[model samples]
Target chain A: MQTTQRPAVSEAVAKSRKKRELIKNVVAYSFIAPNFVGFAVFTLVPMVMAVALAFLSWDGSTNNPITFVGIQNFIDLFQDAKFRQALINTVAYAVITVPLTMAASLGLAILLNQQIRARNFFRTMMFFPYVASMVAVTAVWNMLFNPAMGPVNMILSGLGVENLPRWSVDNNWFICMGTVILFSIWKFMGYYMIIYLAGLQGVNPDLYEAAALDGASPWQRFWYVTLPQLRPTTFFVTVMLTIQCFKVYDIFLMITNFGPGGKTRVLVGNIYEAAFTSRKFGYSSAIAMVLFVLVLIVTLVQFRGEKSMNE
Target chain B: MKEKSGITGGRIAVYVILILLSVLTIIPFAWMLSASLKLNKDVFAWPMEWIPSNPQWANYINIWTKIPLLKYIGNTAILTVVVTLLQLLTSSFAAYAFAKLRFWGRNLLFLGYIATIAMPWQVYMVPQFMMMSGMGLNDKLIAMVCLQAFSAFGVFLMKQFYDGIPDELCEAARIDGLSEYGIWAKIMLPLSKPSLATLTIFTFVNTWNDFLGPLLYLHTDSKKTLQLGLRMFIGQYSAEYGLIMAASVVALIPVLIVFLALQKYFVQGIASSGLKG
Candidate 1:
């Protein structure tokens, strides 16, 4: 802002604004240099490398012959039973969890936005699960879902609901979805609720005041005014959540770790097993490519949706 | 007067529900705390013991002796601090450039930054592993440290904060002879403290909780992060409830403290940034 004095700030500093612009350009490049380089190597470049590796057949072993087997690995995924299970579970996981998670967070944000006493206390309580190491927190969740000693089954029995479906039990499709969905909500509701709360607060109270003058009931005001005003925030949230649910690994890896006949398995889980367990780096890259393609499609749809809304 | 009383009644209902829901949310940890203090067998008694029989505080001490609890704590603290400092510096500079100092490729690069969000880290893990392995930095903490040191998400947040500072304030500084970098470090940064504090807290919390990067990169126990260090406690000598809970509780304190202390900024930061499309 003080650039005006620079009309004569220094002997070397004098010149047209273009000269000054060039100086600023160099400075800005230095500032963002590390980040662009990091993104290129770790993100952009590795992705391209992964794409190239997809067609190569090698087990990452010294003696294994490498061959360019175009379309073979992609074809293999169609017949791979484990890959099918992982794909199905990933789809089911997102379908069940994302909507439920968003709804719960939105509800909690509304409740918390009210003039409740000890609001900060409630906020902290809700956000506690989100602040810990996922492994540690999921270990607790693991015990909670344990068939033998977990509190869930214990609570079920206390209510005389005997013969409860075993959570974390192998091949129990319903229970796998249930446990992962519950854990996913508990893990993230705080963070998202915080986001929703901000959105709720951003909504001008003037609208509420106007509705009150018109004799609108609280529920009517909320449904008519608050909900419509929060659409933009909701759209941003939906996009972010969709991407996150797709990439979810830490919690999935920790709780059940693709458990019980691989019923809870996800694409990332399959990739981990392929690369680390089987030492098939090329195959893992192919799985990653599939995941990349899926995410690309999902994000592009959201971008298109956003553009249509803007228009 | 009837309407006033009805409003009062509704407020009371809200309070009761909020408190009840809060308890349901927090009860698991309370149960964890209770179980952590109980003797091994007391954990599974059918009727259940809500509190520990003896309140064995030594469970906290036992985790230290039985597991590498102290080493894990040290590793987590160092990693959290180092990464937070680096991200704040790198992010702030880039964000300032994006927010105020315009140049060529600026808008395009920002779009590229936003686009990185969709390419989940797994898509690049194989290639990242290749590069780090090539550099011989795989086993070292550098692998984890460098991966996170400059983040696109961090830049996204910092740029938002910078956008809020009036351009006139910056122009005034420029008229007074401040360099673009100097204006950022001086006028802009001090004004952007609230957002910087939020970024600092999140970077620390996320880094501390991060399990994937440390899991992928660090192999040796001595070099292990707290998350990896904590993973060791689960299976060793059966699932001892007391020791594991002790370690888990201890592990949560730092992040919890960090969150509580700077909470106002964290909430405000998210609120501002969460402003939608």
Candidate 2:
């Protein structure tokens, strides 16, 4: 009788434990359900569909049936001149803009981090362009850089410069792409500056003090102490900036209009033109896959580099 | 004496550079403000009229009548408020589960979010368009709301903050007969004011300034948002710089006000979360 009772008590305990576990899962899932349902339906499902759609052909017409095309879209993408030009233009923009923005923002961060008067005011001023509407910002930029009547040209003329390069209007890809790059750097540097400022705050003062005690100059101290300390922040910034550079669309569209005979056209612009304007949804998805792979490679490479640096 | 002089010279050089860059940064905004007050013809007058002799207050008034500006503003305001509130509610709820709850498959579920966050939305936007259209949500403000509301970034940011709050507090609250939901609402939400403000500013500003999402989703005039409205205004009145600037100013005012009021939280939010705003 005693043995049977002991087993019965143990069985009851086990059943209750399972019941509690079930209840816990139900509650936990309930907490995440509101967001997860929406996320799964919109983001996750679409992502899987995007991968499949890249291998299919659809013109985004109601009447056109979706059909599997194998790797034909990708094959066509590589052989397409417009896509090749776009890929090159995008790489050019990223290569030129990313490093310049990084260096400028880092320099600004180091400068502002010093014990300077009106630091907050300066920082706020720098960050103002970032918060402003891109439409408005682009409008003002087009006006300012307008060759015919822009103040920049007016000032340059005053300086006796004859060739006021047709900045936004110039059919020359360099002039057009260069102007967009300049604006991109100006508009976004402040954002990265703030991130760098946060990184600066985390750097221990003792390292700087020790470097100074060893009679290190300001530049030397920065190179040896400040930079090494800010490695993680720099890594984060590079990954973010690289991904952002790949996704450049609005500024290109608004500023260049992919103009000068499609010279300033980037990969995203190519995708937009294909998907929306031409309604070739499958081809667009294929281009998007290329974009995805490029972004993935850059990010993975950065992460690998970061791991090696840590070791 | 030499060190003192060198330090003073360096400080002066810093100030000079700072002032120069500040002027370059503020020039566009200043030009916008000045141009918004001028006549269309006078907007690009040579040598630049930094100040108009007589400000055309009518540009501001005319912008309202130009293209259903009031309707656009109303649409934007509604989207901003609704999206921000929904994101706050859902993200914090999801984050609480991720951070505090010891549930099965927690890490795996959260991994899905982190992975997707890294993937560009453009990569999947075609399928998303099809899915939304199939669901009969395309060309509807509800589509934008559905797409933007459940942000993984919001959940990630909130979870980062929630992870910092000690689990012992939740355990103590549970002992006091409070349920998990009660602990999230009564204990967690109250302590997360700063993070809430951060998320609020982020969602508000992004929703407000968003051009791409609305461009793709909203095509109807009545459904159009401020960014799209502003673009249409530009297309129609390409030469009316003053009126365009006025419309742009009107569109930007709310975001500016929100940013200014919550400026401290905005800076602190970015710093603490290390988010790419």
- DockQ, structure candidate 1: 0.64
Give the poorly placed runs of model 1, Cα more than 4 Å off: A1-21, A61-66, A204-219
lDDT by residue for model 2 (B39-76), tens: 87888888677889999999999988889988998898
The candidate that wins on lDDT is 2
What lDDT is obtained when candidate 2 is compared to the true structure? 0.90
Q: lDDT tens digits, residues A64-119, model 1?
A: 78789998888988899999888887777888888888988888899999887889
Local distance difference test values of all predictions, in order: 0.81, 0.90
Interface RMSD for each predicted structure? 1.8, 1.6
On the 0 to 100 scale, the lDDT of residue A24 in model 2 is 99
- Among all windows of ten consecutive residues in candidate 1 chain B, which has the lowest summed lDDT? B230-239
How do the residues A67-150 of candidate 2 rate in per-residue lDDT, one tens digit apiece? 999999999999999999999988899999999999999999988998999999899889877888888889889888888988
